[model samples]
Target: METVVMRVEELQLGKIVAEDIFANTQYPIIYKNAKIIHEHFRIFEMFNLKEILIYKEKKLEVLTEKQIEVETTIIKLSNYTSFETDYYDAIAQIKREFGNWQAGAKIDITKVRGMIIPLIEKVLEDRSYIFDLNSYSNAKDYLFHHCIATGLIASIISKKLGHDRGTIIQVAIAGMLADSGMAKVAPRIRDKQSALTEIEFAEVRQHPYYSYLLVKDLPALKEVMKVAIYQHHERLNGSGYPKGEKMSSITNFAQIIAVADVFHAMISERLYRLKQSPFKVIEMIKEEEFGKFDAQVVQALVDIVVDLPIGTKIELSNLELGEVMFINKYAPTRPLVKLINSGDIIDLAANRNFYISRVITKEY
Candidate 1:
């Protein structure tokens, strides 16, 4: 038997494991040679397996030849985005960790810190992968996908704010688990495709409190982190929930997580609604009418992410298409763009009337 190293993301759904996979911890033998499933990736990530051996000999009737060719191309090119891999593996680990927490597994603060710090570093080094992963998240569960995105977005904001690594990691963990309360809600309600009744909506709003209770007594986890998780839903202007605490009353950590959570949630796909484009969401966040988030935190996020999808085509408020040309540091949300039709350069920062409606496509 021959084997090749393949990242879990690179694994084809119909592929077979060429060798046994193992976890370094208590659950050592993950599985023997078997067909792969999406859940397998979560298990692989718990122990941080970068690559697994897969039996490439089996033909995948499920996938078209072109799909297989593209997979092979990605592998052969060695086109690695280490950050992207880290970002995904983080989600996988969260699935396992959160499952444990909900199933009466004690919140092991030391273990969680160990698992999440590396994940934060991956995003701090580069946050573009959050957008990349979100795009690929069409098939991912909203809960898992949004948790990881919140974690990544929070850490990126922390990095932009010049927080020390220790502080940043704390915020990342809080962001990752901020909505753990949602796990306690009935799946039927949580997964509902239509608007919830007022009673149902009230239940939905209790999630922050549930998350708070879950981690409140973990001796190893900082009190600050617990507070952040509890208050992540609160707003600066006191419009948010659980407890409508005002801006000055909220901790800075909680404030940062709040901003990240909303941004990631809106940009991510949900069963009930289509996901908003990154540009459009960011624009909404920056507008005066939606000015509930911490101004500094929002700008920090804007500074880090605005010019991120460079070279992507964007639609304007008036529906004209233009290619993003350059970023103006003064106006991170708007960039220098050239009209697709006229080839004329427009500085979006200079023209307040013109703003990106939505990003058409990312360069990657």
Candidate 2:
């Protein structure tokens, strides 16, 4: 870690002091190893301190440079353990359930709940599992990864919105079953790489209705659950197919699923296209899909994503590597990275050419 007297103009967010930064006033201590946030820039100047001793990286984060080795081991353990355990089976079941629905078997709400509840409990009890959700995205079968990621994402966003356990559980349940009706469409069309013809697009739009029909008759489902299934594809702009309902007509549960679905779809690899970076996708959701989706839901998703712990190793698009020095609230995908070889700190947001290509520990 470097210690230097940096001018006020050079200070940026998340700069931590190596030694105590004294002020003129009555405050007890501007203690050593204390981290500065966005609000502290003014506090430094208020005290009339023009320069302060700062470190190359903050010391207060739960993660540390020394601890990164252990965290990497833990991540490697997680991938193997989760793959062998029921985690893989849970996603496998989602795929099977979709096939069962298409085969004229009824929607088994009890079985679906049994599959979703354990995962929801895992994420709820430990929020760090949110980071693992992206790792769980696999390309072997889109629906398997899609449904599982959808549920985990739903619970996270639901809890962000302050929904109770019951609601969160239900949203999780709805998430797993949200796209089940895709089974009704021919696999060839669903996996088509090219733009769909008008007829194919029309067929694709019916999946939500098909999903609604499968779940609507299940007495085990709550009203909100059924509605989430039905309306997940409906947009506020009246551009969505089936009913083409507007903003006021859609329920909040559906809005949550809609956001999660779009996010999972974009991140997970598909036959049609390559996956985009999560940060870029989030930017698109906000900038392009404005009136088409609920803003609150999108913000909740963004809030949940930017919590990437410090010390995480990340890869850039050009194949260079770096470790996360700090998380920037203004831009998440573009966190402060201290390059391993150069020891130079980079603010990813400032450098537009380099976007985080992957989270090394979190992805294979």
Candidate 3:
């Protein structure tokens, strides 16, 4: 049978696989001759299958000329927009739920799980989504965006840390709800544009305990997750709030959420602070906030960002376009970049001024 190499984003329903697809697993992810369906999109993304060999539709020739054109158009129209569409929808839902929680409603674990599960699944399938999450957020809705992005980042970290599927989902939910207690705080404090007074900051710091209280009674949530939600704000050097607990006292899961939470918050555009590049933020987490986070968790994040393959398109902090040529082993974030305009190779490690601002392409 004849087959065509089609980009995964351009795939539509009912295309038959022409060859087996593998992604570092022992067996093929999708067997040859298998027909594609809606779920296959996530699988394709999960494996980062950019293009696949698929058997061409012989049935198209049997249809009318106009019908054949429509079929081709349909195939062209199908793309990777579903994840973004679902993400915005989830954000809107989270905003509504946060309002409900602020209005004295009970914590809805089931609803919260429903909101993040699909999103988690999608991001897990294609982690590149997590790197671009900050773009989806705005200052006005920073709180809502932070909750969702934190969950997604946590799920990625947990997965990288070798957590099982169930635990990863739980961690993601916990990350999303870690700040849920902020709902209980007065709106004047939660939504304030200016800096908070010591009195108000103290009130804000109580959010962790309040978050724990909100989820403590939920039997569906695991005990570890409850603890993680409560302690996510706690730092490693005994400086964290609600309980100022140090190294050995903190759960590893909580640290995972903590790194994820801080990473998203720092990288995201907030009401008071300008957003920093993800690469720069990762550097700060390692060098500046050294003793505040778990080493393993921070390394996991570094691996996630600096694992950029050679030839990946990136935008530098100076608004220059370049393609990564080499990743410095010791300082992976500062790689060798060949500027697009000058066609000159600039070693970022030597030139400390510019850093990778963001990835421009969808896939590395």
Index of the highest-lDDT prediction = 3
Model 3: residue 39 alpha-carbon error in angstroms? 28
Candidate 3: count of backbone clashes, pairs at least 3 residues apart or interchain: 1
* Higher-ranked by TM-score: 2 or 3: 3
What TM-score fits each model? 0.68, 0.75, 0.78
Off by over 4 Å in 2: 1-80, 126-140, 191-194, 362-364
Rank list by TM-score: 3, 2, 1
The worst-scoring run of ten residues by lDDT in candidate 3 lies at 70-79
lDDT of 3 at 80: 46
Sort the predicted structures by lDDT, highest score first. 3, 2, 1
Candidate 2 per-residue lDDT, tens place, 1-364, comes to 7787788788765567778554432222256776565335544543456878877654535444445444322222243355335567787787788788778898888888878787777666555555545556565577777877787788889999999988898898888788888888898888776899999999998998888888888877788888888899889998775799999899899999999999878776676667766767777788888888888999999876665555667777777888765555557557767787887767777788887766664444
Residue 357 in candidate 1 has what lDDT? Answer: 62
Better of 1 and 2 by lDDT: 2
lDDT of 3 by residue, 1-364 (tens): 8889999988777677899786654345567887675546755654467999988898632345454344331111122488788899989999999899888888888899889998898887767777678888999999999999999999999998999999999999999999999999999999999999999999999999988988999998899999999999888899998899999899999999999999999998888888888999999999999999989999998988787655678999999999875556667898767799998778788789899999874543
lDDT of 1: 0.71
